[model samples]
Target chain A: MQIETGELINITDKGNNLFHLIIKADKIADKALPGQFIQVYCSEGESYDPLLPRPFSLFRIEKEKGCLELVFRVVGRGTSWLSKRHTGSSLKLLGPLGRGFTDPREFSRVLIFAGGIGMPPLFSVAEVSKEVDFTLFYGARSQGELIFLERWQQMTDQIFLATDDGSAGQQGNIVELASSLLDSGSADFYYACGPRPMLKAVKRLMAKLKIPGELSLEERMACGVGACLGCVCRTTSGYARVCTEGPVFAAEEVVFNE
Target chain B: MNDPRLIVKVGQFSLKNPVLTASGTFGFAREYNRLFPVSALGGIAAKGLTVQPRAGNPPPRLVETPSGLINAIGLQNPGLTAFLQQELPFLRELGTAVIVNIAGFTIDEFAHLASVLDGETGITALEVNISCPNVKKGGMAFGIHPEAAARVTRTVREATSLPVWVKLSPNVTAITEIAQAVEEAGADAITLINTLPGMAIDIKNRRPVLGNISGGLSGPAVKPVALHHLWQVYKAVKIPIVGMGGISTPEDALEFIMAGATAVAVGTAMFHDPYTPLKIINGLSGYLDVEQVGRVEDLIGIAHKKDGLD
Candidate 1:
């Protein structure tokens, strides 16, 4: 991993409080993978009020243009400060950190599940693997919360969306939609990134169907490296750091906490 | 025309500089080495080690307060045997001082660890962690009491020939009393101000944020407390002090040095920016040049000089 200062090239309001930021970081963009993330130093300069760097997964890696894109929502102080940054401002970034997803080309048919903000990394998977046949199950709280709808529709061979309010595709959650649509041998491999409840439900369903898959996990992090042991999740082996051991892990390896 | 002298002598051992990475914050020095050269710093203290591999506390182990972070990592480490076989060889090649911080649940555990690590080639000193607030037993328990603190120090001192620096807790009523007791009990030097005990509640969840319920507080919020304690300890003992807590910038490190610390460790601030120690090293050289000071050691305890504003 490398620390590089990247200029903010573009910032787009994806609507409903979501934003897409593209940074010009040649080294990070060149090294970053589908599910890997970058730690964004949010403090303006020497200020230590917001004391830790915030982690954001790679939404799109524009290597040819020497740029990296991140999709984030304004949740707390760090992201709030990040959202207000101007395009010309420099952003200090540490990345291409963490283990990312496996190569999608390894499987003939892939199934993807994305929940709200979790869509960024999975969206990257769909964007890069054009040769693989992908079926996507994307969900959000409502039609307004859904982002990159057009891009996702264009990228995947088949797209399924679920909204809690029934204002979009399916009326229920994404896991319910996936369960109703998929059966044994529906796909060779599956991938998911979402809220814990959804991931837990998906893990159970995938086990019942006996399909191998990977899950992207999230935790509050410091150091954004393996050192601190701050961001860890319970796995079959033990508590593994989410920053280094993964933001991605085998579906069966993860043991969700109650 | 020559570079200002950055070398600092702590007891019999001399460090290349005054900036050392704090234990628990810097895990084995492998992570930050990927970003910058680790050999430039004065010293590195590996994570606190125990007799057995600990899984540590449960998740949600960290919470960020105003300008501080509360963490109950519960001294998670690879245990003593793993360190010798796995981490020590890598540390030896770093071309810097390696100070091992040992945490024990009992006095024998502390002595055993020191004895085993005594003749190790790369290790410069043994830092007895009597001040860790996260663990359930034998950490701050031995630290808060002067007699108990001295007993731990005495045992480690008797077990090893290496210079023993006892790290003291800031949570005590009389930090100087504990400092004096350890010094009298044969401590070669002192490392002051392990994190103060703190807790954060998740208001919506109506529960404690950390899995251990309470954790140790570190970062900028504890700077004043750490410096005050360091100043008091400096006056009470002749042993050199390694002052640390909320030290992020060069200015902060200078404050600790002026307050009579031969060295300072950067802890929580490293989590904010891994380059913090390197930045402070450069900043110190710049400060010395501008101030016309010939040596950093000359400035140690200058704030305590009776001629200054007293």
Candidate 2:
């Protein structure tokens, strides 16, 4: 199961600042769960300005190809370097880290609230929830920011779209749309991911509406695994790592910044 | 048939290989266990641990820009005592060398931490991080100033019998001076190039992206800068160097070694690829075999510096 660093390969550059990077790492992939993430070294031959690797969520994986796919935003120097990379580039990856989302087997009607870059994790959850009746309430700052909508639309039976600028579907925060849908008494269980402010507002709305939900939190992380404890969040139990204990947490268990 | 393996001696302990995971990148050797064996690595340099546990900075501690990332993680850790009780036991069992990295707010805190961990059986060494930018006052990082770096190194050296590796920050004007100071103050080795200082803006919000205005930048963007520092400092000091900065592949790791780094460390790459360290190791081995090179150490400082080119 051990692979030499040279064996890690980049299979595809799925454009739009996203990459379908393959590491030739099977053991790590086999053990990887839905909500967990991986740390990838994008630039092989060049050492740019920042000397550290960036952590990303495992977007999709092809076990047959022995490759792992990462859906990442080219936010900074790390990703910008990654975005420029072409095929046949080699990468250094450490992964399948952080505690993933809880399984959706228990819930009947699942609602996934995703925003912008947060859609990656929610996408994974949606893929796993194929057999279940789930409604993905997706939102973005503008219509152009809405990614993976068509592919998700094809997979799930119901998809709701919202944007802050109303360049697309129902305009407003995703929480507003989600709350209205919740009022209709259709959603049984909900999972959400998005900006911190959005997630905070969601947590508050969930409390007001008394909805049972699980939130996948995203905090700035050093080591996507639990090493640095850089991505700690205050929860009802105690301080827990977003990378280790969860990017996913029960709405009731976490204590957001009020 | 020379061994591609490397065994480096730092203080009283001997590391199987000079290679190690940089602090803040690899968790406590346990997080990667499910994917790769912790024992596979030469050692695990844990995240920066302070005297007391810290909550770290506010939200938006990290922002990705260009070929790098800016972070002000603020040294969020479980504190040394908690790490010793909760995480150390598992790390010790992984059969990998454990290097504890310390960041202190004051001279006494650093001294006290070293004293507390002195003669610890599980830990192989201590890496003093004098370069975190998030903290205020004494913690703008001891790595920024030569005297400050030396003082922290000397204080920690006097407190513990373990090998001390002083991790240098790249934000300084003269890296060589700081490197020399750490060496003269009894540091066993040096970890070059922490994240560089940076900032980002969210156009929609028309304000700073991160809650903290400035953050430390890491990833491929800093590799060239890191390599330059390593090369320059290598010529300035006799102590072994651990070079890291945007090292995302085996070739990158090799570049560091050839630039006079005794070993290389993996950092921001872990964010993009979690198995980066193992991949780099595998790559190095394959590369050595393909090149028909006997020992990996022979590649150290092999970069031919053309005189007039500089």
Candidate 3:
């Protein structure tokens, strides 16, 4: 995938303290795959204060509009600036980077798992594919953090929600929910993207059930390409770059530390 | 007319230009494809590879200082084998000379790395990193001492016929001695300076900003130091020098050339502007033509004294 510099055209607060930034970059949209991301340069406040741009998975690409979308939560100065930008704000970007999910060949059933911000990238994967026997397992801290549920639910064949507080769907983690489904012989291959712990949990469950899967690891990156040697993951073979070799790696190949 | 023919030979490799991306900054040169074609630049120095694969240190691995950045990535790499199998194919297809930068924990590790890379003909050059302070032991990064530096360079030089460039650390008191040592040991050229080791305190958190307490400081903060090192070593060694550290602008690239660098590698500048190398290359080409410069090599070491008056 090609890495391009993007200009922030408009930043819309998607309310609930979330933001939907419309960044205009044709190169990003043209080259971006499902799970690939863009490192947004929003550290404009202090010169060299926030050293690097924050990495965000691509949400959707609007080619005709000449813009790409990033759904981000304001957790720091970088996202805060991204959330407040007006139209015609130019933001530098390096992206369409990291290996995305490998497109499955004709499988009977596909299982999709996402927790928190992880849902955004999976949304694209689901959007690109056809009407297959697919089930999406989504988990969050509470009902409010179950982001992009309405639209994603409408897109997929089946939707299962699990929140930590039990304030939403099943009162359990997504891994437990997935284990039951796989036990019922409803899943063929699993695809997951989320925080490290959640991914680790799901990977363990997959291994226990002898189910095959692909995982998208979220690592803090420097170059967002293979150059920085900053975002690296240990695998059965050796070290793999999260930016180039993957953000998505086969479950069997990885050796999760924690 | 712009001289698109700024190609020059550095060591045995013939580069399209004298501008190359510094290791740990340019990311295999693919990151810039969205903005410009990477082939437009002279070359790409792959991120530091290691003997065994490294997961690197935990983030926040990077922190921005005044005009520089401190990164303690800990030489995270997927080892040489995986890189060759997975990433090297794509890198070779980019049609630019790929300089593989390898780090070792021991003398044998460096030799093993070179031996493993010997059969990989797609690689244009091998850059030996002996300057990373973030790793444990043999990250002996070769530049710390003249003896250690020469030993590592000589080992790699014996292992492969590929042109070897030893990337030097800037934290040392004297850099020329090490440069001379590597040159005498048969290094094709030298890349200087690696990031200087430094620390930053998070006033609010009242602790260090980097996960690794100390990180390498790069960017504009280290440009003057880079110039000094380049100036000192350029006179001490007859081999070519690729100057880096905190270069961000065309003027900065010119300054390195004036200080006797045959080429300039843009580092922390990549963090700020991903298209910096292209900009520097284009800017240099423009500056050279306008100044009636006949060749890029003429710019190297032009900052000489008037008949030893200085």
TM-scores for every predicted model:
0.98, 0.75, 0.78
| TM-score attained by model 1 | 0.98
Model 1 chain B weakest 10-residue run by lDDT? B1-10
When candidate 3 is compared with the true two-chain complex, its DockQ is 0.28
Best by TM-score: 1
B1-310, model 3: which lDDT tens digit per residue?
1255577779776788888888877665655655577777788888888877777886667776666677898887678888988778888888777889989888998999998998886898899999988887776445789999999999999999889999888878678889899999999999998888888888887998777898888888888888998999998999999998788788898889888888888777776667778888888888877888877877788896455315
- Give DockQ for candidates 1 onward, in order: 0.83, 0.31, 0.28
Candidate 1 docking band: high
Angstrom error at residue B18, model 1: 0.7
Task: List, residue by residue over B57-148, the lDDT tens digit for candidate 2.
Answer: 76667776766778877887789889889978887888878889888899899998899888567888788988888876556567888998
Best by DockQ: 1
Q: Enumerate clash totals for all models, in the order shown.
A: 0, 61, 6
C-alpha lDDT (0 to 100) for residue A122 of candidate 1 = 94
Poorest 10 consecutive residues of model 3 chain A by lDDT? A43-52
Of 2 and 3, the candidate ahead on DockQ is 2
Candidate 2 off by > 4 Å: A1-188, A193-201, A218-223, A227-241, A254-258, B1-5, B11-13, B249-251, B272-310
